[model samples]
Target: MEVYYSKSAKDALREMTCKLIEVMRAESDNIPFNLALSGGNTARQLFALWQEEYRLLIDWNRIRFYWVDERCVSPEHEDSNFKQAYENLFGPLGIPQTRIYRIRGEEDPSKEANRYSELIDQQLPKKNDLPHFDAIILGIGTDGHTASIFSSCHFLLNDIQIYAVSKHPDTGQLRITLTGPVILNDTPLLIPVIGEDKRKILERLLEARTATEDFPAACIVYRAASAFVFTDITI
Candidate 1:
């Protein structure tokens, strides 16, 4: 696990963009770069950067976009992760629909989960019998959850399925999320945790030495092949 501290959210995102550009440039031209993205205020900020100036630095045609998780809502819904990326990143970059693989959040939770699982098998490279994403961007919830895998839903960490259905601990809202095996695979896990609200949780995660049920975000950093965290929080 590696951490990059920035003075503000904007600076953290700028640092993240610089690293992403390095990954993009290093990718093989013969194959598409599979990128899994998470949604939140941090993601919105990152998308805005890409839309503003960073888009020119990326080869959108060689990138295939996927979501780390999605709320069970219509694609047009304001809460939809795919909607956020489409409006802010994909649409602005003129990325084609064929390169976008989004979880069908409006469908039945179980069915959508299975569908997305199959999509991962079909799209991502296989490693150790699990689909390995090239790069996975994620966010840590203030409650210590990541990718809809709340502390209350620890079974998701043991789930062998590529993707599974989850419910928000507080709202009971359904969500489709990639399981632990896929997330902890050999991929570049980029986590940008901004704001002072996340400071304590980040500290707890950093203190943990192994994958623990207490903090789902910690399990990610401990198990992922390479985890990069960019945070404005001073910790």
Candidate 2:
């Protein structure tokens, strides 16, 4: 694991984008670069930044976008992760639909999870019998959840499936998320944890050297193939 510190959220995100571009560029252009993305207010900020300044820096054509998780709602729903990316990043970049593999959130949660899991298994490259994404970008919730693996749903940390259905600990809202096994595959995990609100949680996560039940984010930090954290919080 490695950490990059920034003075502000925008600066952290700027550095994150540059790092992503660097990773994408290192890949062979003949093949598609698979990237998994998370959705949240922080992601919205990153998308906006991409639309404004980094659009030209990335080879949008070679990029295949996938979601790390999605709310169990219609794609057009206000809470839909795909909707957030489409409106902010895809629309502005004119990324083709052929390259976008979104989880059908409106469908039955179990069925959607199975469908998406299969889709990824068939589309992405495989290493050690698991689909290998070039990179997986995720955001951390203040509660220490990452990719919908909340404290209440810690079982997902060992779920054997590539994707699984998860319920929000408080609201019981259904979500489809990449399971721990797949998430910890031979792929880079990129995280941008910004804002003063995250400092304490980040500190706690940093202090813990191994996966703990209380802080799900610590699992990724300790077990991922490689993890890079970009943050603005001064800690």
Candidate 3:
């Protein structure tokens, strides 16, 4: 796990974007870059920047898009992560239809998770019976949740596949989230976080020597090939 402190949310987003551009430019492997994107305000900023100007720095066709997690909502819904990314980034850049693999959030939760698992099998490069993503971008909540895995309950953390269905304990909303073990075994992981509210959990996550079920975000850093964190919060 590595931590980078940005002076503000804007600076954090800038740093995160710069890191992504660096990755794309430096990549020499022939396989398409598999990116699992998270949703949040900072992500929205990143998406907008890429769509408006920065995305031209890399080969768009060689980059494929996936979601780290998605709320159970229509693609057109205001709360939909895919909608935010599409409106801000994917659509504007005319990303090819075949390259975008989104979770069917509007469908039944368990079935959609299974479908996404199949999609991962079909789209991503396989290693040791699991699909490995090139990058998985994430965001953490104040309550210490990453993706839909919350601190309030014991989630099914032992799944062997790429994605799983977890319900938000409070809202009861279904979420399709990439599993912990799969994330730990994948490529570089980026967590760009912001706001004063995030400071405490960020510190704890940074200090974690072992991943715990209580703090799901720590699972991302557990045995991960490389982990980079960009944050605006003070620890």
Give the best candidate by lDDT. 2
Task: Evaluate residue 181 in candidate 1 and report its C-alpha lDDT on the 0 to 100 scale.
Answer: 82
Better of 1 and 2 by TM-score: 2
Candidate 3 per-residue C-alpha lDDT over 30-62 given as tens digits, one digit per residue, 9 for 90 to 100: 769889999978788878767766766767888
For model 2, the superposed segments whose C-alpha errors exceed 4 Å read: none
Please say which candidate is ahead in lDDT: 1 or 2: 2
Best by TM-score: 2
Q: RMSD of each candidate?
A: 1.1, 0.9, 1.9
Q: Please give the range of 10 consecutive residues that has the lowest summed lDDT in model 2.
A: 212-221
Best-first order by lDDT: 2, 1, 3
- List the candidates' TM-scores in order: 0.96, 0.98, 0.91
Indicate the residue-level lDDT of 81 in model 1.
Answer: 95
lDDT of 1 by residue, 96-205 (tens): 99999999999999999999999899878898888988788999999889998999887898799889999998898999999888888888888999988888888888
lDDT of each: 0.89, 0.91, 0.80
Name the better of 1 and 3 by lDDT. Answer: 1
Better of 2 and 3 by TM-score: 2
* Per-residue lDDT of candidate 2, residues 117-189 (tens digit): 9999999999989999999998999889999999888889889999999999889899999988888887888
Compare candidates 1 and 3 on TM-score and give the better one: 1
Clashing pairs for predicted structure model 3, backbone only: none
In candidate 1, list every pair of residues with a backbone clash.
Answer: none
